[model samples]
Target: MSLINRLSTRSDDFLATLRKLLAFDASQDESIERTSADILKDIQARGDDALLEYTRRFDQVEAASVAALEIPRGEWLAALEALPGEQRQALDSAASRVRGYHERQRSETWTYTEADGTVLGQKISPLDRVGLYVPGGKAAYPSSVLMNAIPAKVAGVAEVIMVTPTPKGTRNPIVLAAAAIAGVDRVWTIGGAQAIGALAYGTASIAAVDKIVGPGNAYVAAAKRRVFGTVGIDMIAGPSEILVICDGSTPADWIAMDLFSQAEHDELAQAILLCPDAAYLDEVEAAIARLLPAMPRADIIRASLSRRGALILVRDLNEACAMANEIAPEHLEISTEDAGKWAEKIRHAGAIFMGRYSSEALGDYCAGPNHVLPTSRTARFSSPLGVYDFQKRSSLIQVSQAGAQTLGRIASTLAHGEGLQAHAASAQYRIKPD
Candidate 1:
C-alpha cells in the first residue's frame, strides 16, 4: 500500500476528508516571536553594537564593526568573474530574461485634461531603496537574488541593499555573483531578525530602506511581521506548494517525479495530484515507490508525501480544475492534452504550468515570471512579486475654477451628510462665491 493518502470523489465524505488532508496550521511559534521581538528592540536601541553582538551569537561571525560586514562592490564583481563559464552564462541568461519580463510590468505616469481644464492623473514613482534578504550557508539560493532584486531595479529603485547570513564566516560565491548580476547596490553579511531589524530600523553602517523583500526562517518571518508598519514587505509566505491536475494521459513516471519535486522542498511542503483514472493513480504509486530509493532527499520526500501529500481521484478534468481553484495552490500544473482548454477554468493559482513538459522547477529558476509567489491559498487575493511592488502611485488632482465650482457642491453635500461641518465649509470655500 502507498504511504500517501488516497481519496475518491465517489465517497460521501470526500470533501471533508480533502479538507482535513489540506489543513495546515500556520500559527507563529511563541518562542520565536518573543525572541524576534527582543532582537528587534535591541537592534533598534543599540544600532551597530547590537547588530554586531547578534551577528556573533547567531551566525558565529565575529566582527569588530558593522561596516566590516558590508561586502564591497569589487568583491561581488570578482565573484561573478570567478564563476565557471557555464554557471556565469546561465546566470546572465536568467538575469536577462527576468529583467526583460519585469520591464513590461513597469508603470508610467499618466494624466488627462478635462474640457474645463481640470487635470487629473496618477504619478508613478519608484521607492528610493529596497532591502533583499537572501538565505546563506547551506541554504543558498541564487535564483532568489534575481527574482527579488531585478524587479526592484526594473521599477527604478535607486538602491537595492542585500542581507545574507554568512554562517561561520562562510560566504557562497554564487550568491555574491548573483548580487552582481542583479545589480544589487550593497551587500551586507547579516541574517535573522537582526538583519530584518537593521534593514527596517537602520544602523550606523546600513541605511534604512523603504521596503524589505525575500524569505528566511521562522525568526525572520516574525521580524518581518513586527516591522511591517515601519517598512513595506512583500508578503508573509507559507510553505511551498504544488497541486497537479492530471488527466491520466501523462506518463506515470513524469507525474510521480513532479510530486517528488515539491515534496523534496521540506517535510511540510505540500504536493498533491488529482486525476480521474484509478488505474493511473496506481501506476503513479508504483512509480513513486520505484523511484524513491534513488532520490538524494528521499527521507524528506517520504515524510512530506506521507503527511500532507495525497492522490485525489476526481470525477473529471473539470472537477479537478474546480478543486485547484478552491486550493489556490502556489503552483498548479495542468498535465493533460489541450492543457490550455482546462486552464481557462482555473481562477486562482500563483503560477500555472501548462502542458506535461512545463515543470514547476523550470518556473522556479529561468521561467521569465517571478518565483516569489503567493502561497497557502493567498493567490485568491495576493499576487506574485513584480515591478509594481516596488513602485508607488500618487493621485494628482488639479481642479480648474469652473471644475471646482461643480466638484465643490458634490463634496459639500456629502460632507454635510457625513456630519462633518468643517469639511463642508472647506469645500464651500473652494467654490467661487456667486
Candidate 2:
C-alpha cells in the first residue's frame, strides 16, 4: 500500500485538504503543563534539594548534591580529545563553519548625530548568560550543541551553561565534545522541567540564565513556555517540517530521501512535495516504496509520511512557489533548474535549500545556517535562531537641551493622547519654556 497522500490542485477541495494536512496542534498537554508547573515551583522553593530529587526520579541518577551533577570543563575537553580523529575533525570543522557564519551576523553598536545635536542610535550587546538543553542518552544531538551554543559565543555571551540528562549515569561523549568545541562554559547532568527551572530560577549550584534554548520533550517545552517571562526562549517549536518544491529535474530517489530526512525525525513531522509534474511524483512514490525497507528508522518515516505527508500536483512552478509561501515550512528545498529564481518568489520560510544538490540534511549539520528553525508555519512572523537571538538591542537617545525642546512636545502630545498623565508630565518637564 502507498503510504503518502497524493493530491492535485484540480481537486474541488484541494485548498481545504491542504490546510487540514498543514494543521499542527501546538497546544501544550494539560497533564504535562500541570506537572511542569509543579516542578518549576518546587525547584523555585527548594532549589538544589528539589533538583537533585527530580534528577534521581526522572533520570535514575542519584547525586548527593546538585553540585555533584556538574560536569567539569576539563571533562568536555577530554571528550573532544577522546573522540576518533575523523569525528573530532568533523566536530571542529562544523564548529568553525558555524562560528564563521555567525560572526557575520553580529550586529555592531551604531549612532547617528542629527542636525539639532541629538545623538540617536542602537546599542547591541549579547546576553549575560544562556542555557542550552541537549537531550541525552540515545537521543544525543551533537549538531544541536553547535547550532545553539556557537551563536551565543559569537554574539559575545559572557557564559553559556549546558544541561543534559544522563540516564542511568550514561553520558554521550559526542555531545560533550560538541559542547567543548562550541565553547559551552558549563554542563549540568539534569533534564526535564527541573533542569529548565534551575536555568530559569537559579539555585545554589546552577546560576540563572538570561535565556534558555534547544529542543526537549513535552514537559521541557511546557516548562519553557511557563517560564518565558522570567527568561527568553528561542521558540516553542512544534514537530519538524519540510516542504520540497521539485521541478521534475531532480532524481526521484534524491527527493524521496529528502522527504525521509525529516519524516524520520518523528511521527508527527510533516514532509510535503509540490510539483507541476505528475509523472515525477509517481517516480518519487516508486522510490519511496523501493527505499523504505532499508532504512533503520523506516517505521518512524512511514508513520510520519502516512499521517502528515503529501505529494501535491500544482499548475506549474509559479503555483508551487505560491503554495510553499503558504506553508512557510521550517525547512524548504527547491530542487529545480535555477532554484534561486523560484527562491526569490518565496516570502516565508525558516531556511531555504537551493538547487538539486543542496539537501536539507546539510543545513541540519555542516551548513553554516542555524538548524534551530521556526516550525508550525511560524516562519510567517518568526525567524531562524541566530546570533541576534542571543543578543539584546537597546535604543540610545542623548538629547541636547535644544533638541529636547522640539522632541518633548511630540512625546507629551502622544503621552497625553494615551491618558498617561504622569508620562505627559515627565515629557513636559523636559520642554523649555519660550
Candidate 3:
C-alpha cells in the first residue's frame, strides 16, 4: 500500500491517469443504459410482474406480492424499540442535530414591491412526497437516514418514504430507529433498481414520489438516471473523492488516514495530496505505508490508492488550488496555516474543510452539511443535497399597466431582434406610446 507513480512522458500525463482513477469513462458503454432502459420499460409496461421478477433476480427476495414488499409500521417501531436505550438515543440525537441544522435552511415565500407597481418574488414549497433509497448492504448506516430524510423533513415535505433492501426477514434495527427518528412516513423492504422503479412509477403498494434521493451501487445510479425525468433526483453521484492541500502543518499520519477514509469507498475512489514541499510528500507516503496495514479495509484502500490516489508535487499553493479546482473533488481539505485564506481560491469543491482539525468524516455524519454530494468533477457545476433539493421555487411576477408598458417595449424590441414575432407581439400588447 505504498504510493506508486507511473512515469509521465509528458506534463499532462497525470490527467490521463486521473481519468482512469476517477473511472470517468467506465459507464460510457451503453450496456447499462440499454439494460436499465429495458428494465424500466418492462416495469413501466408490465408493472408488477417486471418489478417482482427484478426483485427476485437482483435482490433474491421471494415476494409473492407488493404487499409483502411493504414494511409494516409496527415492525418499524418494534425494531427501533428493540434497540437498547443508548443506541436509540444516539440515533435520536443525530436526527435532532440534522433536523436543527436543516431547519435553519428552511425557506419561506417572499415578495418585493417597487414604487413603479411591479411585484416580483418567489414561492417556496416542499414536495408532496419524496422517496429515499437507503442501501442495506455492508453495515448499517443510521447516519445516512438522518442525512437524507432530515432535510426533506425540515423542508416540510408531507411524506418522506424510505425504501431499503432487506433480504428475506433481515431488517436493520438501527436503520429502522434512524428512519423513525427522521420522521419517515413509510418504510419498504425493497432496494436496488427495482425500488427506484417502484418510487419513480408508483406500484400497487408504493406511491409515486416527487423526488428520489440517496446513495447506492452502480445499478442504483443507472436507475436514478433512467427515472430522472419521471421524478426529481438529487444528483448522479460518482465514486467518493478527497483532495488534501497541506503546507506541512498537519501530521503525516493524520493526512494519510484522512486520505484512506475516502479511498476505502471503492477502487474508483480517489485521495490526492497536492503539496509544494517534497519532504512533506515523502513523510505522507511513509505514513500511508505505516497506516495502510492497520486498516481493516486495507485491500480495498490499497487498490484504491494504487489505482486512483496520488501525491502531486505542485509548485506552490496556487498550483495546488489549480489542481484541486480541475479535479473538483467531493471533499477538499486545506491543511495549511490560515487554511481559510487558502480555501478562498477553491471555487469548485462539493465541500471545503478549511483547517487541519476538520476531517472529511465529520462532514460525513455529524456535520450539518450534507454528505451526499457531487463527485467525479461534477462539483464544478453541482452542489450537495440540501433543503433546496426537496423544495421547489416558482417565480412570482406582477406588473401594473404602467409598469408593463415600461418593460414591455424593451422586451418586444429584444424579441424582434431574435426574429420571434409572436413573442414580440405578446410584449407589444402592453407597450404604450408617448
Candidate 4:
C-alpha cells in the first residue's frame, strides 16, 4: 500500500475528496475543557495558594510560595552566557534577524487635521505586558520562546512574562537562554491551565498580562480559550499544514523532504502537493519511500502521510494555484522555475516560500518571518503572528467648536432616529446652549 493518498483533479469527486482531506475535527476534549475550566476557576478564586498546589501536583515542583516558581532574570542571563559558542552565535543571529524584521512591522500613531479644524486619526500603542507560554520538559521549544517573546518586545510591550512547565522541576537551559536573547521581562516555572489562569486573572506573584501568546497542550489551550474575554489570546492554532505547488522543476528529493517537514510535526499535521505532472509525483513518492528509512522521525512522518498527506495531480498550473488559494495552507511552497509568478496568484497562505532554494524549514527557524502561523485552513481568514498582535489601536477624534456645531446636529438627528433620547439630548445640548 502506498504511504500517502493519491488523488487527481480529473476524478468526478475531486472537490469532495479535497474537502474531506482538508477537514479537521477541532472537537474540544470535553474532559480537558472541564478540567481546564475548573482549574481556571480555582486559580481565579484562590490565586497563589491554588497555583502552588497545582504546580506541585502537575509539574511535581513543591514551592514554598508562588513567587518561588519564578526563574530569576539572572538565571536566564547565565543560561545565555553558558551556552556553547556556536549555539550562542546562531541564537544571537536568529534573534537579530527576527527583531530586524519585526521592527519594520511596528505601527505608529498618526492624525490629520480636516478643513474644519477637526482632527481624526488612530493612536497605536503596545500592550503593557504579554504572557508567553513555552512548552517545556522533553518537548521544550526554544524557537517558540524566540518567536512569541521577540514579537511582543518589538511591538514595545513593557514586559514579557514567560511561563513554562518544569517537570520534576528540571528547567530546560536552552529555553531559558532563549528568554534572555528575546528580552523577556520575567520567567516563571509554571505550566498548564493554571498558568493561563494566573496570567489571565492575576495572582499576587503572577501579575496579569494584557495578552497571552504561545502554543500549549489541550489544558493550556482550553484555559486560553475560556479566559479570552479577560485577556487577549493568539489564535488556538490547529495542526500545522504545508501545501506545495510544484511544476516538477525542483529536485524530487527536496520536495519529498519538504512534505516531511510539516508531516513530522504530528500525526495530524497535513502535507500535500498539487502538481500537473503525474510522473514527477511518482518520483517524489519514490523519494519519500527511499528517504523514510533514515529519518529520525520516520514513524511520525509515515503515520501523518498515510493518514492525511496527499499527492494531488491538478489539471494545470492555473488550476493548481486555484486549489492552493482554496486550501489556504499555513505554508505554501511553489517550487517551480518561475515560482514568483505563481506566488503572485496566491492570495491566502500564512507564509509563501518562493523558489526551489527557499525551504519551509528556514522560515520555521531563521528566515526572519514568524513561524507562529495560522494552521489548518484558518489561513483563509487569519494571518501570521507579528508585532501587530501585541499592539492595540485607539481612535482619536478632536472636534473644533465650529466642527462640533455641524457634528452635534448630525449626531442628534441619528440618535433621535434610533430613539436614544438621552443620547439625542446630549448632542442637542452641545448644539444649542439652552
CA lDDT, candidate 3, residue 203: 72
* Model 4 bad stretches (over 4 Å): 432-434
Candidate 1, residues 1-434: lDDT per residue as tens digits? Answer: 35788889899999998888788898989999999999999999999999999999989999988989999999999999999999999999999999999999999999999999999999999999999999999887999999999999999999999999999999999999999999999999999999999999998899999999999999999999999999999999988899999999899999899999999999999999999999999999999999998999999999999998999999998999999999999999999999999999999999999999999988889988999999999999989999999999999999999899999999999999999999999989989877
TM per candidate comes to 0.98, 0.97, 0.91, 0.98
Q: How far is candidate 4 from the true structure (C-alpha RMSD, Å)?
A: 1.2
- lDDT of each structure? 0.94, 0.94, 0.84, 0.93
**Overall local distance difference test of candidate 4:** 0.93
All candidates in order of TM-score, best leading: 1, 4, 2, 3
Q: How many backbone clashes does candidate 1 have?
A: 0
Residues 329-396, candidate 4: write the lDDT tens digits. Answer: 99999988888898999999999999999999999888899999997778889999999999999999
Give me the overall lDDT of model 1: 0.94
Q: What is the lDDT of residue 327 in candidate 2?
A: 91
- Model 1 residue runs over 4 Å out of place are none
Question: Across residues 334-389, which tens digit of lDDT does each residue of candidate 2 receive?
Answer: 99999999999999999999999999999999989999999998999999999999
